[model samples]
Target: MPAAPLSILHVVRQFLPNRGGLEDFVANLAREQARLGHRVRVLTLDRLFSAPEMRLPARETLEGIDIERIPFFGSHRYPVAPSVFRHLGDADLVHVHAIDFFFDAFALARPIHRRPMVATTHGGFFHTNAHSRLKKLWFDGPTRMSVRAYEAIVACSDSDARLFQAIAPGTITVIQNGVDLDKFAGAAAPEPRRALLTIGRFARNKRLDRLLATMQALNAEGPDWRLRIVGVPSDITAAALTAEIDRMGLSGAVTLHTGLDAPAVRALIGQSSLFVSASEYEGFGIALIEALSAGLVPVAHPNDAFAWLKERHPLITLADFADADAAAGAIRGAYDRLARGEVTRGEDLSDYRWSGVAARYIAVYKAALAEAGHGVAATAA
Candidate 1:
């Protein structure tokens, strides 16, 4: 018999009104959980980091999930929000995203709330090479202790799994972030697309500068190639990105869009033939998979997550973004292959479907409840 529905409380620092890989992952997962008959509530901070002046609604329902925003102090890296405890009181299981303050706080509060807790390592703080020594020390000391409190630890990619597995070998599971395949499915034309598209938040590790350099190299090839960049702001500001674009002499050839609606994004995908990203790190490359779902050929930088992807999906083209000429050469080769009908679109990506990913989480939640003696199905096996 199917198990009774469970009440899920998701904890994340950034959410809707905040657009990025982590935010999108939580949104899509919560939506799917709601669809599967789970009562879902997300507890997040009140402000979007990009525009701190603009506050999100304190309480509201979005995409079928109940979300409540509480005030947070401290930096964006580790938001100190003790008030989240008030909201998560009703959840059967607390599912925390990222290894931040919430992950630690909820684990510490587990003894009081007496609810099973689980967390997803959304790339961790290893997104950049910043503070390598301190991060390693923290990972070994504090991160290890916090992880011991979780019923399950989901690593969004193989790379992440390997990292967490070293600390919490027994509890880690690899559930790659799911893509909304239907969102842009079959949006790309069969022939190679002429324009290139890149999407994500403007993090420094995204290496947008390297992408611009690649564009300059492409321009030297004498093709009238244009690039469109769509993303929200995080570590980098919009003004800074603009200055860099102008500095690269790409002001005339590049178009930048922020806060675009899904339809608008889909429209851009329909008009473009290629998708590219020079991201130095990613928990899992959701945008790249979304592009592949749209039937766009992807030229990705060889980050650990993207490298894991390239091994499974043979169509993905990996280029070393460290060198502009080399990256540009890869892009040019991808275009030529498309122009000659050497390859086709519509790659099969059923394995990364949300239904499968959400199902895994649902089972994980059930096992968590049973283990916590909350009276659900017994055995994770």
Candidate 2:
């Protein structure tokens, strides 16, 4: 007959009520696994550094999956919770989300309770600021060490797979993040007024300054376009972004939205004509995919993560990351084409839905378990 259910443990830095692409991915994956008759649980830090006010329960069941939050103590930015090791023996399989985090290192260092261990390298080690020698040394060292600890490593994009291969060099699988297509269901109708949308936290790596400059150049062309940014801002970057907007006299043209739920974000995208991003890097552009599903033409900086996508979707317009003026020109050109009705919607993204994504991960999980000599029959216990 039928194989039994497998017990899976997912480890991440934070969980629901803490908004981000990674958190969403983990939550969705766990929900799908539970729906497929597998026992799934999420383990994360109890405290959220960025949004301390939005505290979550230490133990709770969310969307049919169990979540356990371990109390942590340290600097708000990098809290450490050694107690996760005690719960390591509770699952048949362990999947850690990011390698750069403290919990990943702790999980990798300790015994895995004789279970198959897998790690999904969301961005790999490339997100670190190479300019800081100490930071580079600290992250890079642990990253390489952690890479060797997993039986299989999942990369969200081909670009990320290459980065992980450079370190550990084996059993890396490329499984792009999934998008809930139904949530963004709508026709590709451009708004009467030109509106560009981008979403992410205000981090230096996101390069929001470049996005502002691009908006400045676009506004100078006399079209009077509007740029909508949705994200929580860091203190320093928020001040810098606001000052730059006023200095460029774009206070009326640009809007910053914070604390938007998923439905609100989809509604914002549905109302926009174009989705734009100036991020220097991305493991997999989850927001971009969501925008594409919503039929918004994408205008983004060139990055290795999206190289495969650029080849498949001609509607995507990529601008050189080094030049803001050229990037702005590209965005304006795309907008002009949209205005002229040259392009209406993005390519069909039915393949990247959550059900298919969950199935792919299940296959990878089975392969990892089989390779470790724990066949499906054995894991069913």
Candidate 3:
């Protein structure tokens, strides 16, 4: 006899189309799990994640998974819906994304219900600057309370796991963010030339200014490279930084596109000679891996979670943390070095495919269930 598949309810803060990384990860995981014969559903916040835009229906079915978007509130940055607990009664497991942001749901979900609840802490405000001292204090207080609710914690990278443990101090599972290889199959890298690319929200932590500075430095040496910055930009940050471009005389060298779909974003990355990241920190470098799978070399400051991949693959370049300028200089130097048959592109990326990733997640799911005192039958095991 075969064992029955577990019914899962996944909770996320929001799921807008243009949101990167976590949105895609959650969507893929939900869809793939359904395809693998598991019952899956999604519950997210109702409000639009960004500026006035078409929102998905408040309640709908997507690829056989039930999706319910509800209105909940804590702050402009983090929202929650208490109604999630009502629907969770039917699920064998409850998976939550960005634990710190959606703590309200955890409070609504009582341990007396006995369903295994796993929380993945995607981001925290510890690294962000609060507008006031009171806001900073309030943020940390809520975060600590949230971390105490989870039966298990998941961190997408080793750095995130270590960081989570430092604050929460408990067992944390580290999982690498995975990409859908098939979606990038037809996308091809353009002829290698003086072109570079990067994507992210235009915030201080993203350090888009550093990438622009790198381009200015490279053009100063006469490589005449062009950079395309594809991402949503915060109005305040954009207003503050636009003058810097004119000051550097890089008006023609840099372009910023506000939003794009997944295919469009991957196509843009595919055509570039290299993918660059100047982030001060990252939970996981999803775009870096996407660019690498699309056959573009990745250059960034060393991130501990990515160290394993870098050691095994020569396709990535690392910059010194103290000076992003040196990192930019090295990337330009890598472009020069490419002509000697040193750079590789369009490498078969089946290894990073979501199917492989789904298998790993299933293993974690089973392990989590076991830890919570659920015994899956031997056949399923």
Give the winner by lDDT: 1
- Candidate 3 lDDT at 202 equals 71
Quote model 2's TM-score.
Answer: 0.90
Question: 1-381, model 2: which lDDT tens digit per residue?
Answer: 116787889998877666677888999999877777788889998877665556678888866668888887776445677787777655878888876454355546646456677888888546536556865575567666766666788989888887777766776888988877776766334553478998887777678878888888887778478888987664235667778888888899898877788778777776688888888878788877877878888888877766667787788999974676898889878888987878867577877889889888888888888877888632211
Is candidate 1 or 2 superior in lDDT?
1
Q: After superposition, how far is residue 237 of candidate 3 from its true place, in Å?
A: 6.8
lDDT of each: 0.87, 0.76, 0.69
Q: Lowest summed-lDDT stretch of 10 residues in model 3?
A: 372-381
Quote each prediction's TM-score: 0.96, 0.90, 0.84
Show how many residue pairs clash in every candidate, following the order shown.
1, 0, 0
Better of 2 and 3 by lDDT: 2
Instruction: Look at candidate 3 and tell me the lDDT of residue 129.
Output: 49
Query: Whose TM-score is greatest here?
Result: 1
Writing each residue's lDDT as its tens digit, candidate 1 over 1-381 gives: 235677789989999867888888899999988777777889999998898888889998876678899998888888898898888766888999999999888878778888898899999889999889999998998899999888889999989999998889867888879988998888875556568999998889999999999999999967588899999988999889999999888998888899997888998888889999999999999999999999899999999999999998877999999998999999999999889888767778998898889888888887777777887732222
User: Which residue runs of candidate 2 sit more than 4 Å off their true CA positions?
Assistant: 53-55, 75-78, 102-108, 128-140, 187-192, 234-240, 377-381
State the lDDT of candidate 3 residue by residue for 46-108, as single tens digits: 665564344567788765667888776666565545666566657877888875455544644
Clash pairs, model 1 backbone: 193-273
